[model samples]
Target: MAKYTEEEIRNFKKITCKIAGDYLGVSSMAVSIGMRNDLLPIGFAIKKDDDRYSESWSYHIVDERLIAYKHGKINELQIQNIEKNLNTIIEQFEEMKKDLLFILSEDVD
Candidate 1:
């Protein structure tokens, strides 16, 4: 139910940009601009297959220009919760797919 304002998002992007620049020896402008231009890859997902489960994660990114938020983007605790939820979904997928013929794609034995 909670959401982020455009200004707040910009602020976050700005802070992130600074942090990234300091640690990576990259340009802060790159990060800031990436955030502003919608160039950041922020989505997170977990993919599962028969042999193994794949983890692909991205943040719930709002448009750089528009800025948005759900329940998870507000704080560290919420972010952890969101990540956990995503991971859980992947686990459920693995469990459900374990025995399904369609999941294996091809029979090994």
Candidate 2:
């Protein structure tokens, strides 16, 4: 896999499994399980083993993959599931927007 510099990473529009799940109208755990079971494709996994409490891991999926999925390029099963759960995905997106607004409104002294 190709390695990206910090600056490149900063500019990249990466999404987490949790957020991907939201986009897919599924739970984060379902997304995780799919990845583990090879039912989903991951562009790469970044591991941060230096954390004291527990090893931190991040999965990066290519933007193209997401776009394709959004455009019905994925498997039939996924397409069906996504269509069936569209409402949930929209709700998640709304909730995330609210959360972002709240965070941005905080007073940072």
lDDT (CA) for every model shown?
A: 0.47, 0.64
Pairing residues by index, what is the TM-score of model 2?
A: 0.42
Clashing pairs in 2: none
Please give the lDDT score for candidate 1: 0.47
lDDT of 1 by residue, 1-109 (tens): 2343545555664334444444334565655555444454333222334445654322233344223222223544554677799999999998887868665766655
Runs in model 2 deviating more than 4 A are: 1-12, 45-56, 75-109
Report the Cα RMSD per candidate.
12.7, 17.2
**In model 1, where do residues sit more than 4 Å from their true spots?**
1-73, 102-109
Q: Worst lDDT window (10 residues) for model 2?
A: 1-10
- lDDT by residue (50-101, candidate 2, tens digit) is 8989967667666555556645677647655765699788999999999988
Clashes in candidate 2: how many? 0
